[model samples]
Target: MAESANPIPRKAAPVRTKIDHLRLDVVGPVATLTLNRPERHNALSLDMYHQIPEMLSRLEIDRTVSSLVIRGCGLRAFSAGADITEFTTVRAGAEGARLYNLAVAEAERAISNFHAPTIAMVHGFCIGGGCGLALSCDLRLADTAAAFGITPARLGFAYSLESTKRLMDLAGPAEASYLLFSGRRVSAERALWNGLVNEVHPPEELEKVTYELAVEISKRAPMSLRATKEIIGLVRAGQVRDDDYTTALRNDLFESSDYIEGVEAFLGKRPPHFSGC
Candidate 1:
């Protein structure tokens, strides 16, 4: 795989954490968050939802991490969705459902609002809540064997509006309706057609491809990435024209040190060392 323009070598060992059914591995500038319960197809337990926000909050302030990749530990699935075994206890009643729903919303919100870009590297089954998780990411890269679906219809419950909007935004209402209404899994190729995934690679190449993309993105000016993400979100929220804030943001970027460096690097025919100023 190709390295970043301003390459940061791999660490002697990746900084890793093993807790809460999630594993975090931080290399030089890309962090990978793995859903770790492969025994259950990495089914998300209730506590995993609570842990996500907390984990992301830490990463949000860590300047060392410029990009994040989310995936499952094993090849069987990205996730099988929320742990059904917990439904009897964690999502049993109205209040239980409410709390569970709140946690899911918070976790997804954290991902959507994360400072750095997020990529979902999907393989095998990405269903129900798992599909929502992938949609929350800024990008989704999947292997050919990956399958995606929004399956609330099968569960006899309504999907959250926030999650529904995300699906609608990416795949549009018609395709989103098909997934939600039929609860049928789509092949990775179909997912690509629906705009659910950015790319689909052979299973053997997915990891190398995903990390290569993440590393390439990490080498860019951080300020540009952050601003662009925010601006895109604004556009998604119906801000079609530039407002005062957008105008100011654009003006500031032009005056930034990284912008000057980029220009100079182009003239010098050398890679820019972006300090993210």
Candidate 2:
């Protein structure tokens, strides 16, 4: 069989980190952030929620990382959602609930605002806050066996407005209402149809597919990626017209060295090496 014109780049040795219930692994330009409590279906503990923003901050400074994949440590789940075990104590009073909710929002915001593209590699159960985290990513690739749900209605808790908006944007208001009202688990195929997931793969092939996408994205001009991400965000925020900031952003890309390399490489029919300048 003829190989692809742009072959998948060979992966580099992963630099691993042990940060309690979460794991961070970087291989080449791709970083994998794993929810590591597999024994509890990769539930997000209170401390784990607190760690997310800090973890993302560390990655933001590493220019070498062009993309990130957020997943679970095991095949059983992407995340079953926030640890209910802590709800009684950590979310006990009005003050506790306020702080806990703030932590969740901040963590999701960090992921949503990450400079690089973020992919959520999901499998098994993605429920409640787990679904929120996945929705926060730029894209979601799921295993065929994966199931997704948001269950705040069942818990008698109000879902955050940010999370609800994200869901509404991806799956539309009708589908979002159904999920929110029923608290039913939708299969991977159904989720795909509803636009909840970008793609669905067999369990055995999920990792391969997700990482290949990450590598392909990493190969693009970094400035372009960042600019596009921000531009789309602006559009989402109802800024359709080009403002001073957008004009400056556009001007910078044109003046960048990567733009020159990209043009030259295109004319030469070769891959361009982007310096992210």
Candidate 3:
């Protein structure tokens, strides 16, 4: 047979998510959300962005969960960023891009506003929107050889204001501007020095160091940690108002069962069993 001169075009199959691009598993009092796309360096699709906030919301009210950790499954990357190939189709123009950016912003806010302390356990490449994800967390811990960058400029795209503001809050103007302008990957040491990551450990020690931090945070009084996280965000925004919510947050901690346990434990010279009340 000569075969056809031209092949007929067929519709692409819709992406399957029965097996989630994101996975949530609760280990003891800690909830770990793993980005499950290592084949593409855990690149995030629109669906993964949407799923993150949902998982965060679920964990926010689960009293049993004392903390949350976000990471990629394999060694190559925490996440390479948004799936850029999606751009050619569903994300082709300004409107599509606007909607996509909105989803990304919402996911970031969810992480930043999460009720429990959250950690970004980064390894390998954490770039573009990946950096946004890490910045959204309460803390970022990176492998010593990990690479970090935020490169909207490389794509001829302006950085989103909310993401830029968060990055600025973490690294200050000079460091943020340097990263944004050059769009170059910085090593773990440079990332630590620039305040882009809280700590950097050798690849062999990355998990040990990150989870140790998570464990220490989990052992603290949960209510106090949650309130502190909330207040610090306000402080960063130059907020000083003692409004109703602020006043309540300040007062209610004293009334919590954890408060009583903390005090009793201090006096008794024993570990406290906080109920997170």
Candidate 4:
């Protein structure tokens, strides 16, 4: 048979980069981020530390996104914490460890400082840095199968003050101490009781429940949500002083379109269509 000429053209391949290690997806007013390293149970890699903050920066300016969700690739873990294999290589010496820790700190700060509300959708093992990630979010929603623990004691490392304070804020000093001291995984029931998680669902219900919650949050008045988040942060840090910045934000609420719409909708006996002004 004679050779036939090929007619179909192949599509161009997408450009790729190191940050592809993290998957970022935005749908409507919500963004979902998946830590793409599943073979290591979604261990937070070195690239991820830099990538997380960069991605968060993008979302910070994205007005369309009202919320963000961070999760691992599979049901096995939200994350297994940092990539331990790198410790023997890149993070070998004290200086390396310090640098690595700094990267991790910046990543956590990015998440915690995100302008919009964030949620930790936890399933399976959320340990060490993973635990820190979950704690950074405004809320934690998990499957009953999920477990959480801070394993710095197990790794022969002391936990950072900010991380410890977050644990203390949520689980109380006693519970936080117990976890850090023991490095034992806490069951979902225990985590929930300790206030480590907001809600626990069956495995099948976890995603459905989490997305529903995110959707509900996204529909609310954006400025109100942002103000509430800031207020909560001030309360947490005990920085409730009415400085000029704080005073300005408080005043802006009165001028916001959302406030006017809310009032009109209430008086008109209709659902408020807040423009998130």
Candidate 5:
């Protein structure tokens, strides 16, 4: 009777290897991205450059994701800049430079216009293209160990006008010019003083503090945050001359669910639990 039937062996579950250069993880309403090429100090390869736009697109459409946090893996650096190896080939001539510049422009636009609030949780080196990524974020929280520079001058390359303007917006004309001219790394304190970063935390506390700040931001009204970001963009572009959309957004917020919850919670002496509706 025991030999009458044979049991079938079960197949093993698949094991997932970490992506070699980029890591994406979700915690509650926050999506965290890590540059994973630690052996090369997280140098930005062409593949890494392309993967960023796709990742940002994914995060943008995920309604559950209210905010994002970006940092480097292994704590050595956020990104040491573009992979110089690839640059040798990609920057070889005018045609090559044109294609490479187009790719960079697409990446920059994707990061800057992503729907959710984004935070750059920077540590160690954030230079060149890395600074471009960090500047695209709505907020930047750097560790005391962090350093920043835009090194196109040293490389005999001219930065895109949009990238230069973004840096100027964060650091002002004088500091932006100094860094661009010298190609010198600025200290975290200097970056903070120049408004390049929203806050500077100790190295050990950077991850924890950045996560806390992301959660705080995620708990706010989504519509208000999105509208504010859009309005800021219009203002920056010199396109916000008494627009009806901007006025409507301001009026609509008064009647939002978040506003109702906010008032009730205040009266009850409790924290508002916004659903982001």
Candidate 6:
């Protein structure tokens, strides 16, 4: 049999687009969202905060995406936290602070509810609002050079119930209290020990290692992964009984295509190729 040769030409690469304080790049099934204000230690400005929810919405609906990585543009910071300079003018009084806090609450909600699994690759200063952002993600990976802190105490601002609870879920009540009350920077090793970070790598290996983790996650079944995330959120919110959902999901996984592939590959002594079905 002779193979037919076609003359259809390949299309040009899509134009790479970038927003003012954020950059989205997709390679294969993994998407990386970078906070782009490196000159300011990637501080979360009002504009950047507003842009996040919108960007996350787009990623959630994009079928091509299988995993997400949130990171800072430079090694100096994942974020230095909310831009305090803007707070001076934007949060001038009690009423203004109330409104600002409400907006922040909405942004945090969006991150916490993102459809796919998310990883925060933290380095340098991840403080105040940055900590809230990282804690919202499904997993957090920090570099050896990273520092973690929640600075509500230092700024004389009260932390929201949701943000406080998220931190407590990661580090337990006692550790969360220490960080929130003192506003002290903790080393990456301490953050890991306290359960704030799932993994810590050398500074030079951070980005590469983060991408590899994302790739591994992308190989899992999409439905099962998303269901697991949803169940975790339900448990965290105290809206559901853990045993009920846990057992149902475990049974559901047995019928999944990825699970079949995983088992077969194990028996066959080969690597499994999962389509995330």
Report the lDDT of model 4 for residue 157.
Answer: 85
> Where is model 4 more than 4 Å wrong at Cα?
1-18, 240-244
Count of backbone clashes, every candidate in sequence: 0, 0, 0, 0, 0, 0
How do the residues 97-177 of candidate 1 rate in per-residue lDDT, one tens digit apiece? 999999999999999998889999998899888888889999999999999978889989999988998999999999989
Query: What's every prediction's RMSD, in angstroms?
Result: 3.2, 3.9, 10.3, 7.7, 9.2, 7.3
Winner of 1 and 6 under TM-score: 1
Query: Residue 8 deviation, candidate 1, in Å?
Result: 10
Cα deviation at 198, candidate 1, in Å, is: 0.5
Which prediction has the highest lDDT against the true structure? 2
Question: For residues 1-277, what per-residue lDDT tens digits would candidate 4 score against the true structure?
Answer: 1111211111332122236669777777778777878889899888888789898788787787788878787788999998888888878889988988898889888988888899999979999988888899999999899989899988888888888888999999999999999999999999999999999998767877788888788878999999989988888997857888788988999999999998899999998887887
- Compared with the true structure, all predictions reach lDDT values of 0.89, 0.91, 0.83, 0.84, 0.81, 0.82
Q: Which stretches in model 3 have alpha-carbon errors above 4 Å?
A: 1-19, 241-244
TM-scores of all candidate predictions against the true structure: 0.95, 0.95, 0.91, 0.91, 0.89, 0.87
Off by over 4 Å in 5: 1-20, 239-241
Better by lDDT, candidate 6 or 4: 4
Q: Compose the digit string of candidate 6's lDDT tens values, residues 162-247.
A: 99999999999999999988999999999999999999998877777887788888777777777888888878888755586578
Sort all candidates by lDDT, best to worst.
2, 1, 4, 3, 6, 5
Candidate 5 lDDT, 38-103, residue by residue in tens: 888888877777778887777776777788877777666888988889877976789988887777
Model 1, position 238, has a per-residue lDDT of 80
